[model samples]
Target: MAGGGRGGTGWSSLPADLLLAIFALLSSDADRVRFRAVCAAWATAAAAWCPRPWLVGSRTDRSGRGGGTVSSFWLFRPAGAGAALLRPFAATVPEGLDYLSSSRGYLALADPSVSPKAVVLVNPVTGRRVRLPPIGFFKRWLDVTTVVLSADPGGAAEWAAVAVGFPTTSLAYYSSAAGAWARLDFAAPGYAGVEHYSGRFYVAFGSRICALEADGDAPAVIPLERVDDDGADGSDDEPKLPGGSGRRVVETHLVECDGQLLLVSVHDDVVYSSDDDMGGLAVDEGGSKGGGDARAVEVHRVEWLWDGLVRLVRETDLGRNALFLGRNRAFALSAAEFPACRVNCVYLVDRQGHPDGVVRVLDLENPWACREETICPDDATGGSASSAGWARRGWFFPNY
Candidate 1:
């Protein structure tokens, strides 16, 4: 009561440093947001405290609740040898809105019920919404892989939202500062992913990271120096799994961890549901690897040379942070800050292979080697159940 309650004479009068000290101990992001809402002084002191991310797309079984308007979001924490804690993070999102991309604590969801399809940014926890202007050139909103926000919606300043897809190299963005949705085209397309790092937005191609300068008007792309079959342990080189699993595809993501940006490459091995000559990728009721799982994963440190280019330095281990990658925009969390998170590890949802929504928990220290863990919604039976669409919408840092 001495530091954070009411008027000038009451708890709000305490030193700003003391309020921040208490904020550090609260742990959860929602608790910190509540603390900030105490008063203007408390909110000012908490401006610098960044909370760990909570995965975005978790839903309770429709067996109860009659398929209401809001769908709950959850965070999966490692509980024991083979268990998880599916804690409710954002519990009030609209029912039918499919999660397309997430940024600034809001999910860019596609409304499929409509004829042409609409994209709306929804703050899952608060039920706030921002309707973006439709790009006439681009009608396919669901195909967008990731959405990046310049700042949180409804804030004092103007903000922007950028949507990117690996398969579709076209950049479709909406800037509040500019007042309309614009699509930026590229002459040569080789981008595998895109992410915001430091102060600039970057696109990934092979082992290259390029900054997209002057986005809305007169944009220019600059790629970093590429490494070829180099490094002490072939880290920069795109990794390949031991020859057994048929038809493998590796996806790369740029993640900011412990003050530096990291390039993470994941190899998803394809599996078929039956022994019959299947025409396409299908999974029935199986394919969960336990006992030192050998899913190939690689992490590389991005060393910015500053003069319009950067280089990739191979990282053998992540000290205390775990990188979350899958369907959602990639984010990193420290185990020291969030105890439930496993240090030197990765929680990856298989978007390419698994149909039953089985998440692979890989140990970063030894990418091929991993411990057994079972992650699923608390309401569901296990990972064997059909939840492909829900599982693909991964985690996000819900700011509020």
Candidate 2:
């Protein structure tokens, strides 16, 4: 009735509060951007509300291989099947860039075509990019296992970026305030994973958890104590490393949920074959071709004890949050926020060389009830059941 006078009511006639509420329900960043473009009032309201996160997918070639010229990307709504292909800013993201990791809406990319590989951070939403020193700066390390950011580069005045490699003997970190990459002196030969939480960097080396400051000072190492070990039950069938080897190959992940740090341990078994290339060696105990298929995953909540030591508090169940762990980045989403997502579950992309690009959902409460779904369907990625498709893929979170 407010704008009922001549040519019916228009979107601009809507009240500011009502427009803010309606825009808040929009889960897509593109939709929110269009909403703000409607009029001046709508734009003002939309600028105040925080938008929900979106799951982004990189466009692969028809063959589903990892690195090629990527002209466009895809966005998937967390709550529904709505997806859209988006073109990134030209200067920010160049052609033939391979995505490695994502944090706070920024992507860490590598250009394989260049000598000594070029690494840069890209924010697609803001069209901002910052190129770091070449990968060779990190002591000529060919591959970086994980990269994490201390703050969003788009909004923060100062930020820190950490790049770690497998069999890590030291860490290479970049601080915006210093405008240079500095090496953190530490020896972690069996480094499993690294994560940034609570203004500190945490690393998992073998079975030990160590904490370091963002600038790489004040180190504290903690050993994890398992409460439910089979040895404690006096069982002779205690689990041991594969092939009766005393040393075990484990995959570790550090995640932050509800303002708490969580350590996830995934047991892996390494298999050696004379005919196979060392680059394609399998890391999982399941004898799979890749390390993507984890045999067992255990989650533990980190607790700071009174004796100035850190201990792991095992969590039997996750209440409403579901975790998604990829090759480098990890995400925690609550079912209450997105009803379509399952609670107490872990979702991961197919690592077993499956052509279908299947995503596996593991239910922590009922481990035997695991399920698999195809994300890059045949029609989406242009891959058949037999073709080796989309070798390199990752999850992206867009914040605008």
Candidate 3:
């Protein structure tokens, strides 16, 4: 008969390796840290497994300071024991322009006051920033700047940063490769959304949606007809209207989902896909022979892409009004509402609920509780009658 060690209740005699393995399964980083000090052997294992640095989610509202020049701001994250305040260290920034775009860990700054205004690229986390050469749009009918971060897998090892400006008269693009800004001699109506998708950059201003190829060169705008095709084929295609004519068109918004670029256009009640191709537009044999009109464009009639995004939306307990979209699985906050939690930095949870998904709030700090008015400026608060802003502004239940 083998002799067992003391505390035979089963924990004392367990090998250090076995004990460490059991502790490794714990998800809480705080819990993991405490377990390490239980023993020297345990500490060694804990250090290796707990190497992920905790990135604080605290962000300032660039639009909320000084006056109404900037609007209300909200900061949010997943709910859990880790839900703590996210504070920022002081930093310097240029005057006038707002921070319009962020990607590849950098923020795009545009100065609206200056003629041919200067657009500066900044990385707040690393404290590194750069100002690009000016664009000649001072006297023009308002030029808007948008920036996106992209990685060209088929080309450069480093990520590519693109800045696009649309003036009433023309359009232009800037790239880190040129190390300078240049003009794009084209016309677009007006873009409602711009973002980076799947290692490639995307733009949705006006009626047309465009993408840059992963090869890292100047990307061509996709004509309305071919907007659905993948970008793998290389053809020198110029943008054109539905009748292959030069008429301007535009969309209200665009979003990236499951590797595909989706656009919701204002012209027609349709939702078109770029098939995740860095390509511009696509067409079918039977439709869009005109090239610009959404000839057979896949349609989803919701005005906002978020409305048709059924996957992220879910029903909650509060008369099915509360809903939450989790990073892993969806959950509900109240009714058609999802409460923010403190698990990680997850502010952009759609109405969809998920396991890891959480809604983060800036002022209402606890991730494990709720307040009478979960939403700011809500109908309950004498603001707009619509509660949409309440959800969009990032409020959630405290899961921790």
Candidate 4:
């Protein structure tokens, strides 16, 4: 037997369930992979630990594990649950390649090492990987607006779906099971961004919010206007916004908060944008019919409260500013407004006062903080914020 090896008692000696329980407690993806390498028994333990897509009522806890992990994960440890980046699995991709987007626990990476224009989809937790289909001609031209990983709303196992938006106003999808890429049936190549939440996936383009219905053969596309019709499309020649003023030109971001789809944008300090047009406005002649990117869009004044609980606790005109939400509320911060020409502190405006109490201010400057707001922009525009409860441990892995 090898020195220091447990010759007498192997991993099999452990009660199968007990081994599973222990593995479940170690949330770090790197740790999980390391445990598998110890011996065949450990590997078996990991294989037997296939997680069901949904763990009902099982909250994501991420409090301990010291600083961070090698990759990012929404994981649970005995201490707590939160989002963190686990160490990257040993894989080949070029260096300086950064993470682009993530959804359904999968990430899209842009590494210059492999191909100059390709994005790699990988599950940091299991080190499962899939190379995105070649963007072909589009790769040679338009910049990729967004590349997000999502699960089929219909409940497919171990199969992740990829949604990519192009500046050419096109949207493409790639599925793990299909092993191929195809364009979504929707028209208006103006598709800009995507997000997944509450058993559904959403894409925001021009002024439309479309939902993905994976329950059928092919994912069904439903316009979100049925629920909330008031969305802004910036392509209109003479855009109309609330308050009789022209709509503030700004970008949109999608976030899953408290089981509801949330829209956030930063237009101006203290005066985030708001969409009072309950009727749901539309851009007139914005489509190709319009000469320019005439997409007529509405902006909403947003005040992020605590987590996803509160909406519009404050108000402002949103435009080039960056917005972020946590728990029930949201915050709007703009680099252009700050004298330092950068965000230094991101104060959480709870009902009573700032969560940090003004003394030990939340360091918005922390790379982690910036990423909190920026990495997963509701619109995938890229910015940063503080580490959420679940994002602490895996902060080491860059989520882009």
Best by lDDT: 1
lDDT (Cα, tens digit) per residue for candidate 1, span 1-400: 5544545467777688898899989855557768988889898888756555655553323232111223344554454534445564445567776666677688777655555655788875456798876666664554556777767886748776667755655776667877676766642243255677776677664465667775547556665655433444323333333233433435667888888988776654444333332221112222354222234456778876655445667676788987787754687888787776787777776542233444566665642233534454333436624443342356666665
**Candidate number of the best TM-score:** 1
Separate clash counts for every candidate: 2, 3, 68, 79
Residue-level error in angstroms, candidate 1, position 392: 3.9
lDDT of 3 by residue, 244-354 (tens): 433233333344433344443223222333333212222222121112222111111112233222111110112222222211111223211223232211122222111
Q: Give each model a TM-score.
A: 0.73, 0.70, 0.41, 0.44
Write one digit per residue (lDDT tens) for candidate 2, span 201-302.
Answer: 777654466665553443233333333333352121123332343234355678898888887655453333332212212122332323244444557788
C-alpha positional error of residue 371 in candidate 2 after TM-score superposition, expressed in Å: 5.2
Q: 318 in model 1: Cα distance from truth in Å?
A: 1.3
In the order shown, the candidates' Cα RMSDs to the true structure are: 7.5, 8.1, 15.2, 15.2
TM match of model 1 to true structure: 0.73
- Determine which window of 10 residues in candidate 3 has minimal summed lDDT: 308-317
Tens digit per residue, CA lDDT, model 4, 136-210: 535532235455555522246645454554343445566666665555655554324466655556665434456
- lDDT-sorted candidate list, best first: 1, 2, 4, 3
How many residue pairs in model 2 have overlapping backbones? 3
**Regions of model 1 farther than 4 Å from truth:** 1-35, 41-52, 58-73, 76-83, 88-90, 186-191, 227-249, 270-294, 352-355, 367-369, 379-391
* Deviation from native of the Cα of residue 5 in model 4, angstroms: 17
